[model samples]
Target chain A: MTVKLYRYLEDAAGRWPDKIAVQEVDGSFITYRELDRLSDRMRDRLVELGIRPGDRVGFWIRKSIDAVATIFGVLKAGAAYVPMDPTAPPTRNNYILADCGVAVIVIENRFEPMLIAEPSAQGAYPAILVIGGAGGGVHLRAMLDEKDRHAEAPSAVSAPVRPEDLAFVLYTSGSTGRPKGVQLSHLNAVSFVEWCAEIFALLPTDRFSSHAPFHFDLSVFDIFSAAKHGGTLVLIGEEVGKQPLELAHLIADLEITIWYSAPSILSLMAQFGELESRNFSSLRFVLFAGEVFPVAHLRSLVKYWPHPRYFNLYGPTETNVCTFYEVPTPIPEDRTEPMPIGKVCSHLEGILIDADGRAVEKGTEGELCIRGSGVTRGYWNLPEQSRKCFVEVAGATYYRTGDIAKEEPSGNLRYLGRSDRMIKKRGFRVELGEIEVCLYRHTGVREAAVVALADDTLGMRVHAHVVSKDGRTLSLIEMKTFCSEHIPIYMIPDRFSFHPSLPKTSTDKVDYQTLKFWSGG
Target chain B: MTHESSAMSIVKEFILDEFLPGEEPSRLTPTTALVSTGILDSLATLKLVTFLEQTFDIQVKAHEADEEHLNTLHTICELVDSKR
Candidate 1:
């Protein structure tokens, strides 16, 4: 239990001091020795800034090599890192920062305005470490550049941390008006990372692609897998990552041996990335998760890159990849149904139960619950929410997945549907109720209902229906601008419809089935 | 209006209709950074590309659909014209 997540990097540094640790594609590369030294210096700077053990440190900067080092640096300081989406609305970011009460924040200078909106009530704002030519704040470059500062760093060891200590917190959409932070301990994450290393047979020679943002749970696998095995992680920035062609080229040029990202990205690369002319022979394993990949697009990817083994990873942020499906190569032409989320991962336990919380027979659909090493300790600062997530069945507690699933005779779990209003839009989990909550807060809005519909290009689309308090039609433009200033852009409704009244069920709840039918979903 | 001006108008209208519903068309200038300014995420970019392809009767290549070419309104116009 003494071994925490940061030990992987420390151990890797010892084994492969000269090997490349983290690289920015077509930009710069840092060796394991440099990363170790930089992280140690970063740890020293954080400790000097009064970041104590178990303190949460916020990272609001874009993904870069320095950010990678900063992650380990915070870990070495015996603190948990909380990452906020740099592109999210200022209000959303401020809410998360205020909710977590982070001791310090690392941000790019350009976002000073966004941080300015934070309410000045929390006993002095978090100390800032700005990345770009720090103005009135400590320079992040000072932590990475070791020429003069390394001599100033203290040789004192940081406080000891246990495996159960907090490692990182990831915030996901909540049914309430605000987002909820999912707290994962070092044990929670280290166990999942170790399981991936074992299941994937990760090697020191493998080159992993860091496609997901650090705030996402998906990024945990990319960073720790490389650290644990002394592999190289090539960080892909947002600009290149958003461009299908550039990302496809990066996979080839960087010689990414292991490619892990959402199925949306893979589908994009397959559709418009000009994959026919691209080279993907270096890809040894390709993994996709978060949302279902349409079989057609997945088939096209298989056609072009038939060399790499494809895997479908399934899990929520609460449990890091509890189950996964290994796609059979050369998908049979007539296979219409998408592959099932395969057997539960060896490290975790899955249970399917009915609405009454009783175990269901095989082939009967029920909610999927997971328990074991990867299940998080709970949500940050929300004891009630945490306690509600667990239900004791037959004397063992399991975290409810909120997903409906059927157990096939072959032991694989077939994902049927969701029991809640949650949906994944472009790999980001969004709760429709959250959008409704935002709309309800709008002045003169009497009622709001939101639903997600499947889309060919965008993975899924959000549609919102609203009723005006005065029965006057609401301006679509004003509504959109209102939403843009409040919620993250991804959660914004693609289209808004006005109705004097919405259809309701006998229980007086808005009928989402009617909405979905009207949407032709 | 000339065909060029008409093309500009059409593109502006589409941008307002899809991405920036309430924003003034004049504010979205030719030099505005569409992709970098957080207006056009990957989903928005795909929709814009489809609009350009279907409306302009041209095909946008993979490399042409990058930030370098699609970041600015001017660059997007240039990309569409070149494809035509």
Candidate 2:
């Protein structure tokens, strides 16, 4: 086995040089050999740009063959890639760039204005490498063209990447209103990839759909597992992923064998899309994670597209994927119970522990703690926050996943809810406190509280209740406009309610339970 | 109100009720850019699309869901009018 992550691409190229490795919905395709060569040229360019081992590179490009090549090139150059959502608010992307101190950023022409507009005051902004179109930054195409003109193959001086070296830093919302970057090592990512490749029985003939964006950890499995197994990876763009009927058609047209995404997306497709009328003959495996799968929707999907094997995976961005549950044959038609998160993946051990660090009895719910090679190092640059989650227990390090779960007698794990106020809204993990902070940042707002309301479609919907200072009032449009400038759109509350004064506990803290009850959430 | 005005009213009401409850309807004009102003995200846009289809009895093609056609209230009204 290779120690570095990019070695999968190299090995795949050697084996299936002419095989189509990745294809976009618009019919653009990249063969294994072409992918390998492009990434090699990109790696050479990075070396020439003085990117050393351990340097952080940022990727804010759209989902394309070039984006994939850039990611592999960054990994090959022995640098960690920080992927920011291109559609995300530029302020949020700039915050991540400043936070990680990225040495360079790979971007497309469309996103140039967004990045150029938000100049980092902290001096952490890196040099930009434009993928297409004429831009002010270093044109990536020109660099590759220059390399091609030389007629000499770049030296094969590969960066010496070890298994323990950092592979990527994925930023997620922090409870403290700022985003925290989770540092994952090559070993951490590879262990999860190899386990998935084995568990799913992937083959070179299998065509996998990359439904999740690069920023989401789910995409790690989509991109790498396909590369590792030499399977064809179909890149599903954001626009197509949103259009349910279109996505359904593409799934059939491309003959995607492995389908992986958040359960909510699949549920949306089933609800709005003509899923029941469509033919999904080529699909063999359907995997979902990030949120609970509503049993009713799952049943409908199983009935509609009957060929695929169903699975429910559960994990946090901190740990790529620690637990997985395979849907049993003949799903109960009337079953209403929440599906079990099931067993831990190989080489990982999870325990339910109480607040005082004591193990909970079977059938009792407690915070889930995972300890193994899959556990990430910790949050980047936030030592205090890192210490709060990653702790030494019994001389072994364990990541305290804020989720509460109960251990079944059959050794399966049942997810309860978050021990903290963190909730998953539209398959994106959001901290209510973070939204409240954004709300309070407005001058007209005096007090604010954010809560998650359970929704049948969206895993959860955010609702914000506020008490204005004096007689001042703020409209929802104004509040949303203010928030859009500060936070990502997904974090914005779905509904807003105003109160004269917020209820408080005896301790003077905002009484959230009372708010939840009064609001009927 | 005529059919176009009623359709516009319904669209504005839905946006306000879901995204900005209790806000004045006048704040959102016929030219307000829902998509550009960050009011309708991917999921929210889908919800709006569903509402248009069910309420107006119009089919919203996947290609017509872009900002050019569905971003502003004017374009949305135009789309509904054209489909109807």
CAPRI verdict on model 2? Answer: acceptable
- What residue pairs are clashing in model 1? none
Task: Candidate 1: count the clashes.
Answer: 0
lDDT of 2 by residue, A1-521 (tens): 67689999999999999999988887878899988887888888787777889998998887878788888989999999999887677888988987888888877767777785234456544777766732211245565786568754455566899998999999988888988999999999998998897798899999999999988999999989999999999999876786777888899889999999988888878776788666789898999999888888887788788778989999999997899999975678889886999988996888888888777888999989998877898999998888899656677778999999998999999999998999876567788998998899998899999888777777777778998887556776778778877887778887678889899999999999988887786
Against the correct fold, how does model 1 do in TM-score? 0.90
**lDDT at A161 for candidate 1?**
87
Model 2 CA deviation exceeding 4 Å by range: A116-125, A133-143, A146-156, A470-473, B1-21, B36-38, B41-47, B50-58, B66-68, B81-84
Alpha-carbon lDDT, every model: 0.84, 0.84
| DockQ of every candidate | 0.30, 0.49
Residue-by-residue lDDT tens digits, candidate 1, A1-521: 33588888888999999999988875578888888877888898888778888898998877877788888999999999998887678888888988888888888878877785343354667887767732111245553454344445564465588878898999999999789999998988988987887789999999999999888889999999999999999998766777887788889878999999988889889987788776788899999999888888899899999999999999999998999999998988888788899888888999998989988998999999999988988898899999988888888999999999998989899999899889997788999889999899899799999989888767888889888999877765567657877887678888777788988999999998998887777
> What lDDT would candidate 2 get against the real structure?
0.84
